[model samples]
Target: MGPLPLNYRRPEYVSEEDSRQEENSADFYDKVDASLQSGPSGTSTGIPDALTFDKIINGGTCPPCTVRDFMNYLIYIEHAAENLQFHLWYRDYVKRFDAAPASEIALSPEWTQTMEEDTIAKIQKDAADKAKKVSPIAREIFRGTDFEKAPEIRVESRDPFSTPPRSSSGDSVSLSGSQATTYVSQEGDAFFAAGVKQPFTIQPFRSEINRVIATYIVDDSPRQLNLSAREQKAVVRALSYTTHPSALRTLSQNIENTLRRQAHPNFIRWTICNGNPARVTFARGLGVGTILVAMTGSIILTLSKAGRGWRALFAILWVIGIATLITAAKGMCVVLHGLHHRHVRPWELFIDDNATGIEQLCEGKRSFDSFDSCNSYEDEPWVVRYQRRFYVRKVFDRQVWIQEPVLRQIQDTIFLQSMLLALLGGGTLTAIFLAVPAGNFF
Candidate 1:
C-alpha cells in the first residue's frame, strides 16, 4: 500500500499555564510522541471489517447519511473490481494460450491476434483514465459496448476465494500463508440486477481503495470542496467494501484527516432535480395560471360590487391560486406526491414530508406516520433513514389521488372550501378598500 499523509488529531484544549508547563517538561513531550505513534482512541482507529454487505449499506452512524451516499460509496469498489476483473480475464484466458501452437487454440490465429490487441489497448486506456480518480467506465458505458454487460469475474488459484491450484502430485494446498480464505469467506448474499442474480461479491482491494481516497480526498480534491458529515459518512461506507479484512487500519487515519482538512463545497454545486419532466412542466404552467387568475379576481373586485357574496367568492379563489402556485414551484404535482408517482432525488431522504403536507392541504387531516402522531426518526439506523423514502411510496390507503391521479388531484371537497375561503378573503379586503376611498387617502 502507498504511504498515507500523516494524520494529526485535534488535541484537547489545555490552560495556558498548563501548556507552558508541558512545553517546559520532557515528560509531556514524551507523552505527546507516544500518543501520536499509537494513534487516537476508539474502534474507528482500527481496520473496519470489509466482508459485511449491511456494513457497506449503512454509511456510518450519522444523521443525513443515506442510501444515495451508499451508491456513491460503491463507485470506487466497482471500478477497482472492474479493472481487476478485466486483467484477470486476460491472464486466465488469452495469456494461458500464448505458448500453444496456433492449431491447438480454439480460435483462428487472426482472431486471437485481434483479441490480444483489443485487450491490451483497453488495459492501457483504463490505466490512463484512472489518473483523474473517477472511473472511466461511465464514459465507456454510453458508447454501448461489451462493458455495458456486468464485467466478467474469475478468481485466480492464488486468490483466497478460489480453490487452491493442484500440484504435480495432485494435492490441493488450500492453506496459503495468512490467506486461508475460501469463496465462503465472502459469506454474503449476492447483488441482483435486472432480475438476474450475480454471484461474484463486489469488493475492492485495500491498496486500490487507499489510492482512490488519496487521489480524490487528500491530494487532488478541488480546494473549494468542503467535506461535510454526510461526505465523511460516505467515506466510512466506502471503507466497508474493501476486500482486505482490516481495511480501516490501513485507511481510517488518512480518511479522517482528508475529510476534516478539505474545504467545503460551495452552496450551489452541480445538482439535478430528479422529477418527471412532463409533470414538472405541467405544475409550472398551472402555477402561472393560478397566479394570473388571482390577479384577475383582484382586478374584478376593483370594478364590481363590494357585496358580501362577491367578496366571499374571490377570497376562496385567491387561496386556491396561492396553494397551486406553491405546489407547482416545488416540482410536486400534489397529485403525484399523494399517489406515490414521483422521481426521488438523491437528496430526498424523506418522502413522508410530501404525504403529510398534501394530506393537510387536501383534507385538513393528519397521517398515521406524521411525526407528531407517531414515533419520530430521531436517531434510527441508516436503513431506517432509507425506510422513510420507501414509506413515501406506500399509497394504498391515501384518498387524495384516487385512481388516475393528476395535477387535478387536489380538486376535492377541501379544494372547493379553499376556493370559497380565497373569494371571501379577497372580497372582504376589496370592501374594506372601497369603504376608505383611495382619492381621500392620496
Candidate 2:
C-alpha cells in the first residue's frame, strides 16, 4: 500500500524499460572509456593514427588490413614534418632574430668539453634504444629518421658554369657561356642566351658568385633543405677568397642575400621527381577530380550571385580550383609533407617478409603502445609476406588502390620554367573572374 511495507518483499520481473535503461548506461560508460583512451587533440593519437605510415603501407583496419605501429614510413614522416616546420621556424623566429637591431640569434647553451661529450653520448644511447625497441624484425622496416647530421652542400668542379680557362700568357680568361642556349638553375629560373649575352662586365659580379654557389649543392635534396653551419661558413669564406680584398665587403653582402634565396621553401612539388613511372602516370589520372570540383564551384557561383554570399563563394571555389590543379598536376601532398613522410614506396621494400618476420611482428603487437598492458585492444601488425601476396593475388584492382600511387607524387619542386606560362595564364583568368558578375564569371 505504501510502496510495499518493510515486511513484504516485492517479486522480481523482466521489463522492456529495464533493458533500455541498462543499454543506455552501457553506452555512456563506453563513451567515457573512449575519451579516457583518446590522446590529446581528441584524436586516437594527437596525430590521427590512420595518417601514420603503417596504414599507408598495410591498409585499413578491416579484416583484410594489416597494421604496423612502428613503420619506417612513420619515421620518415616525422622528420619531413620537422624539416618543413624548420623553414617556417627560420622565417618567423630566426628571421626576426636576424632583423633585430640588438638581438642576434642565440646559440645553444655553452657546454664544457666533458658536457659536450656527455650530450653526444646520450644522443647515441637514445638512438640505440630506439633501434633495440623495434626488435631485429622491425629493423628492416623501421629505418631511423634521426639523422646524425643533415647533408651538406659540396662544391663540385665547374658547377653552374663552363670551365674557366687561362690564356696562353697565363692571365685568367673571362668566365664564359653561350647566351643563346637556355640554362635551368636550381631555383628553376631559365635564362635565354639573348638575356645574358651582353653580360661579361665585372658589374653584378656579386650575383655571379652567388649563382655559382647555387650550382654547388646536390640536386637530390630539396631546396627547402638547410645547409649545415660549417658548410654555410665555408660557402661565405670561399666566396670571400674569390673576390678581391677591396671587394670583400660586397662579397659578404652577396653571400648573405644568396642564403635567403637558397633556403626559400618550395611552393610546389612534382611526383615525377621522386616517384616511379607507375606513380607519375597515376597522378595524371586525378585531373578529372579537379575538373569536377571546378565545375561544381562554377555552378554554385553562378546560382548564388544574388548577394555577398556569392562573392565569398566565388573566392572559395577559385582558391579550391587553384589548389586542385596544382595538386593534380604537381603531385604535392601537404599532409605527407607536414608529417615528413614521402609516400614513395612500400614497407616491404625495407623489411623481410618471411614467416619469421610475421612471427616477430605479431609477438607483442598491441592497439595502443603506451596504454595498459592488460588492455584487450587488438592491433596485430600486418604480416608483410601475407599482405603483399594478397595485393598481388587481387592484381591490386581495389578501389583504394588508386590513392596509393597518387600519395607518392606529392612533395615535388614544380619546374618554374615550365609552370611560369601556366601561372600567368591562371592569374589573368582569376583577375577576369573576380571582376565579372558571378553568373558570367566563367
Candidate 3:
C-alpha cells in the first residue's frame, strides 16, 4: 500500500466531548491564574502564568498558590462568622424585648440583667488577670513598700467654704499614699464625707463629680440610685459656693485676656477660641527668616573665596538652606490647641446646680421663692459666670495640641524620606569636596 496514501487514512479527529473538555480545562487554568494574581498579602509570583490549562484541568497541583488561596478564603469566612454572630445576638436581644408587655417592658432593664451579671463577672476576672500581669512592672517602678505604711486622710468639712481635712480627729490633713479622706459641708448644716483607701487617692473632688455627671448622662436608671446619692451630696456641696455666673464670667474673661497677650498671637487665639488657624504665619515667617540668613551668610563666604570651586560650595549651601526651610514649613506642630473649654462647665461642676439652674430657668422662679427648693447663693448668675471663666482659664487655655497615633505614623514616613535626602546631599557634598583641588579654595 506504499505507506498508505497520505490522505487515505482517516485523520485522528477530536470528538465534541474532547473539545468541550479542552475548553473546560482552559477555563479552570484561567480562574487559577486570576486567583493567584489577586492573592492575599498583595504581591504575586508569575510562576503560575506558565501553567498549561490541560494540566490544571487534569488535576495537576499548584501547592503554594492553593495554600495561599485557602488561607485567604479562611480569613473571609472568619470575618463573616463574626458579623453573623453580632447580628444574631442583636436580633435576639431585640426580639426578646419586643415581645414583652408594655408594663413589663418599662420595668425591664435596657440591658439583659442575667447577661449583664455574667458579662460583668467576666470583665472583672479579665481585669484582675490583666492587673496581675502588670503588677510586677508597677512594683518595680514604685520601688518601695512605703505605700502600705502611709497614713490615710479622712476629709471633713465644717462650712460650705471650708476645705475638708483628711482626718476629722486630726488638726492637719495627711495627703500621703492611696488612703486619703476629705470632708465637705453639705446643704443645711449637713456634712459630706469620703474615705479613699490604697491604690486609690482623692483626686480633686471635681473629677468625682464629673464621673457622676457622665454616669447620669449615659444611664439614668434608678439602679444607680446609690451612686447618685453619694455623688449628689458631694456635687451639691462643692457647687454651693462656686459656679456663679459672675464668677464664671470673671474667670473666663481673665483667661481670654491673658491668652491674647502672649507673644505668639495665633497660638494665643487658639488657646482662647480653641480653634486651629489654617495657616501659622509666625512660624512660617521664622522659617523663611532662618533660610534667608543662612543663604546670605553662604553668599558672603562664597565672595571671600578666590576660585570657581566656591560656586559649587555656595550652590550646596543654598540647597541645604532651602531644603531645611521647606522641611520646617511642612512639619506640623504636634501640640496644637482646639476649640474646647479647659474647665468644667458651670453646669458640669455640680449636677445639683445644673438641675436647679435648668428648673429655675425654665420656670422663671428663684430658688428663694420656695423653701422646699434646694436653693443656694452659689446658683446666682454672677457665680455661674465666674465658674465658667475659671474653667476656661484653668482647664481649656492650658491645653496644647498633641499628635494622634495616625498623624505620628505619617510624620515617621516623612522623617524617613528626609533622612534619605540628607544622606544623599551629604554624600554629594563630600564627593565635591574630595574632587576639588585645595588651591581652588582661597
Candidate 4:
C-alpha cells in the first residue's frame, strides 16, 4: 500500500450518492474547510500562499519553523495531533529497522515452538551468566552510566523545563533538565557497549512493534490514530509477517500526507495569528498612558510663560511617548526587541486543565489526559532556561519566553518603524513650537 487514492473514501462513510459519483467526495472529518482555514470569523489570519505546507513543516532560513513547531501547533491549537506523532515515531522506527542485521530481521516460521522457546531460554541464561561474571562494584559503575541508555517513554508534565528524574544511586542526575530517566537492563547495556550484540533475533524488534500497535494502532489505544479499520488491520497483518519498517511504509505515507496537506497549512495560519512578537496588555496600556501624559504636559508648557528653549526640551518626552505608542500599535515592545525574545501566549501554554479553547475549534470534547499522549516536546533537548527567573507576577502571571528568529525580525522592523515615526512626529511638533512666539498662548 502507498498513498491513499486522491479521491479515496472510507467504505463505512461512503454514501450511496458518493458511490454513484465519478469522484468520491474527500473525507471531511478531521479537516478544516476553506472558510475555516485559519481562526475565528472576520479575523484576518493573513496566511500566505507562498508559505506552502513543506515550507511550514520543514521551515526555511527566515520563518524559523520546524516539524517540532508544527507539532506544537497541532497539540495546542489544532486537534488530531496523533497523525504527526505516529509519523515521527515511524520515521525513527524505520531508521532503526534499516540498521538491524538483515539476516535477523525476521524470525524463522519453520522453527518449531519448542525450538523457539529453547533458543530464547539459552539466550536468557547466557545473559544471566555474563551478568554474574562482572564484580558488584563494576556492575554498579556500569549501571551508573548515563550516556547510552535508550530514551524513556515521555511523561506528560505541563512544565517543559522540569528537572530529570533522579538516578537510582540517589544522586541528582542533572544531565539535562528536559531528559526523563529510563531504566534499561544493565546486562543488555553492558553487552551492547562491550561490542557484543544481543544474540536473540527478531524478538526485540517484534516486541517494539507490538508496543507500537498497542499504543497508536489499536482501536482503544491512548493515542489511537485516525486510520480506518481496513488500514489498521493491514498494518497489523504486515507486521505479523515481518517486523521490518517497510511494513509501516504505507501507513507512514498516508499520515505524512495528512500532516503535510492538512495539519501543516493549519499550523502556518496559527503561527500567523499567535507567533508574532508583541507587547502584552499591560505594556500596551502603559504606552497609551505615557502618550496621554505627554500630550497634557505639552499643552501645559505651551500655555505657561515658559521660554521657547524650555518648551523645545519637551521634544524628548514627545519622542519617547510617540515611539512607545507606535510600538504598541504594531504589537511590538521596544524592551523585548532589545532582549531578543517574545512571551509565549496563554493559549500556547494550554494552562487550563481541559485546554479550554481546543474544543471550540471542533465539535467534540477531548479528555485532558489524552491531550498529553502525543506531546511535541516529549524528547526535546535541554536548553538554558533564559526566562526561568524572569517574571512580572509569579502567581497570577507567568511569562514563558521563546527566542523565535522570524518574530525577532518582525520586532526589529517594528522598532525601526516606531523610531522613524517618533523622530518625524517629534521634529515637526518641535519646529512649530519654535516658530511660535513665546507667551503668545499665555
Candidate 5:
C-alpha cells in the first residue's frame, strides 16, 4: 500500500477536456473581433482605414502610425451633429409666418383726414410759437435777405428798333432804388429792410439763397405765380441789359445785324453774349495782350540804353513791366511774385455793364411780380429755378463769373505798373553793358 498506485492517487490528466476548452476560447475571441469590424450591417465594416478619418476631417489622409487621426474623427462627428441640429431649427423657423401688415396698408379716407388735421394743427401751433419767439429785430433781419428787397435800379429791354424813352437826365430811364445793403454781426449778417414786399432785399448769403429762391418760385399763393413764356423772356432780356450794360450795345448790334439778315426773332435773342464762348475768348485776349506789352517794352528799353549799369536796370524794369501788364490784364499781378518772394500788386478794374447783364440773363427764371411762368420740363421746383440756374451757370460758366472780380482787383493796383516800369529801366542799363565791347571784359 506504500506507493500503491502512484498513478491512481495522482489526479487524472484530462487532455480531451483541456483541448475542447482551449478551442472554445479561441472561437469567442474571433467572434468579438468580427463584431467590432462589422457595424450593424451584416457586411464587413472595414472600420474606415484609420487614415480615412483624417482625410475627411482635415482634407487629407492621416499619415500611417499617427494616433491623432482617431481623435480628429471624433471631433468631426461632434461638429456634424451640431450642424444637423441647426439645420432642423432653421427649417422650422422659415416654414412659419407671424407678422402684422404695415401701417401704410391702413391708409383710408378717415385715417388720412385725421392725419391731415393733426399735421395742420401741429404746424400752426409751431408757427405761432416761432413767431412769438422771434424778435422784431430778427424779423427785420430775415426780411432783408431777398436780393430784390429793393426795387430795380435800372431796367432795359431787348428791342433795338425802338429807342428807350429818355429820363429827366436824357439817359435811358433808370429805376430808382438803392443797392442791397449788407449787415455784419457775430451771429450772422442779414440784408433787408423791415416790412419790405416779397422778394425783399438782403445781402445774398450762401446758405439762404437757394431756399429763398425756391420758396418764391414754388408758392402759388395767388400773390406769386409764374409769368407767361413771352413775358418771362421779355423780363429776362430786360434784366440782362440792366445787369450787363457793356454787353448791351454788343447785344443790340447783334440783334440789328440778325434782323437785317432776316433771322428769326428767337434766334436774334438767343445770340445774347454768345454764352460761355465769348468770355473764354476775352480771357485769352487779355493774357496775350499782357505778354506782348511786356516783350515790346523790354525790347525798346534794351535798345535805348548803353553800359552795364543801364542794362541791368533795364532788365529789372522789363521783368517788372511784364508782371504789371499781366496783373493789369488779368488781375493776377503776382504771377512771378511767388518765385521771387515779391508781393502781388492789387488788381485793376474792368468796367463792363455787359458782365452784369449776362449774369442776370443766364440766371434762369425768377418769380417776378408773383406771376412768372415756370419751365415745367425743368426738374427744379419753381422757387428754386433761378437759384439752381445761378449755381449751374457759375460752376460751368466760371470764366464769365470770374471776370468782374479779376477786373476790379487789377484796377486798384496802379503802383504795380510803376514798379514794372522801374524794372524795365534797370534792364535798359544791362543791355548797354552787353552791347559795349569794352564793358564786357569787367
Candidate 6:
C-alpha cells in the first residue's frame, strides 16, 4: 500500500509503448492505491449481498480467481505471497498432525504426565504389597487410623487419554479454528490421546517444525512473516512441548484474517478491472460484422421506399446491432453471457518457434499415419506450462473457464445494459420513423 517497490514492472504487456507508459503512469498507481483501501467489500461484485469473501476463496469451480491466479497476484501485485503459502502449508500440516501415530502423539506433555502418573501408581502398589506382608495386628491398627489414607495426586483440566471433542455427527472437531473440520482417522484418534494443551515434539515433526521456524518464524529468514514478538514467542514455546498443529493456530488465524480483510476484497476489485475479460478477438469481430449488416439493412430500406411495416422492421436490426456494438465495446459477448467458458486465444495454442523446438520436431514427421511416432516429445498440461511462462495470465485466456459468481454478476449487468440500450434506441427510432410517411423524402 505504501509506494509500490521501485523495481515493480508490469507483468502483462499488450504493446511495448503501452507497457512503457503504464510503468511510469500515475493513474495506475492511483488505481492500486484505491484498491488497497478498505471500504465496502464489493467492487463489481455485490459483496455480502450476492457474494462474500468466503465464496471468493472457496467457491467450487467458479471462484472469481483461481488459487493460482490469486497466488500470482499476491506474488507480483500485492508482494505478500508468503501469507498464502504459510496458510496453505499450515492447513496440510494440521491434517498430517491429526493423522500422526500413537507413539508420536504420546510425546505430548499431557501424555508424559499420564505415563508419570502410571509409574507413581505402580510404585504405590508395590509399597501396598509390602504392607500386606506386615503383621495382621499392625495392618489392622493402621487400617482404622487417618494415617492409612493415601494422598491423592490431583491433575487438573487436562487428561491425555480423554476422547476429543466431537460434533453432532460425532466427527472430531478441528482444534485449530472455530470452524469444525473432520480429521479423525478410522483408528482410535491420536489427537484425543495426545491432548491439545501442550506442544508436540516428536522426531520427524520436530525437524519439520524446526524447518518452519527457520523459514517463516525467524526475523532474518527469507519470507519471514510480520508476526509480533509475543506471538512468535508463544508459538515457539507451544511447539517446544509437542509437534501438535494447534501450536501455530494463532499465527495461521492472524494471517488468514489479514488476507480476508485486506488482500481478498482488493483482489476481487483487481479482477473487475483486469481479469474479467468477457470476450476475445473473435467475438469482437462478430460484433463489427453485425454492425455492418445493420447499416446495410438501413440503406436498403431507405432506397426501396418500403412500406411502414417494412420500415418498422428496421427496429430488429437496430436492437441486434446496438446490443452487439455495446458488447464489443465492453469486451463482452452476449452468447457467452453467464457462461464460465471462453475461446482459447490463437496465440495461446501456438508454440513459439523461437522459444521451443517445434520446427525441429516437425522436420521428418509425416501426417496421419506416423503421428503416434512423435511421442518422443513429452507433454505437460498447458496450464502448468503456461504458468511457467513470463506472462501473468488472466482468467479469460483461451481454453480457460471461470465460474466466478462476481464475474457472472458483472456479465449479467453488462447484458442487461445492452438490452436496455437496444430497447431505448430501437424504440425511439421506430417511433420517429412511424411519424413520417415511408415513401416521402421529408
**Native-vs-model 2 lDDT?**
0.31
Q: Give the runs in model 1 whose Cα sits over 4 Å from its true position.
A: 1-56, 59-274, 305-308, 344-442
Q: Decide which is better by TM-score, 2 or 3.
A: 2
Off by over 4 Å in 4: 1-84, 104-204, 226-247, 250-279, 298-332, 341-414, 421-442
TM-score for each model: 0.28, 0.23, 0.22, 0.41, 0.17, 0.41
Answer with 2 or 6, whichever has the higher TM-score: 6
Model 5 alpha-carbon drift over 4 Å, by segment: 1-294, 314-317, 320-442
Backbone clashes (count) for model 2? 11
Predictions: Cα RMSD each:
23.6, 28.9, 33.0, 20.0, 43.7, 22.3
Q: Model 3: residues >4 Å from true position, as ranges?
A: 1-279, 306-324, 328-331, 334-403, 422-442
lDDT of 4 at 143: 84
lDDT of 2 by residue, 1-442 (tens): 0111112211122232442343346474453344334243222211223322223223543211122322222222222221222222233433443454432112212223453345334434443453344445545555575533333323222111122222322121112222212122321221121112222223223344334333322122122123332223233333333322222232222222221111111111121233333343444444345435655654566545454344334444344444434543444332333343443243333234433766546543422222112222123233343355443333222122223222222122232322343355445554554565656443
- List lDDT for all candidates, in order: 0.32, 0.31, 0.31, 0.49, 0.29, 0.50
Candidate 5 lDDT trough over 10 residues, lowest sum: 186-195
lDDT of 3: 0.31
The list of candidate 6 runs beyond 4 A from truth reads 1-81, 101-204, 217-243, 258-318, 321-331, 335-340, 343-421, 428-442
- Model 5 lDDT tens row, 1-442: 0111111111112232342353346474454344334243211221122212222233343221122222221122111121112222222322321121324212211213343345334434443453356466666877857631433323222222232232433222222112222211200111111111232122222123222222221122111112222222222232222222221223323232222222111111111112233233443454456445555544554456344343344454355544444443332323222222121110101113223766544432232112223213234233243344453343233222222221222222333443545456545644644565532222
Q: Can you rank all candidates by TM-score, best first?
A: 4, 6, 1, 2, 3, 5
Model 6 lDDT tens row, 149-181? 544433222111122233332121222212212
Report the lDDT of model 1 for residue 276. 39
lDDT of 6: 0.50
Clashes of 4: 0
Write down the worst ten-residue block by lDDT for model 1: 263-272
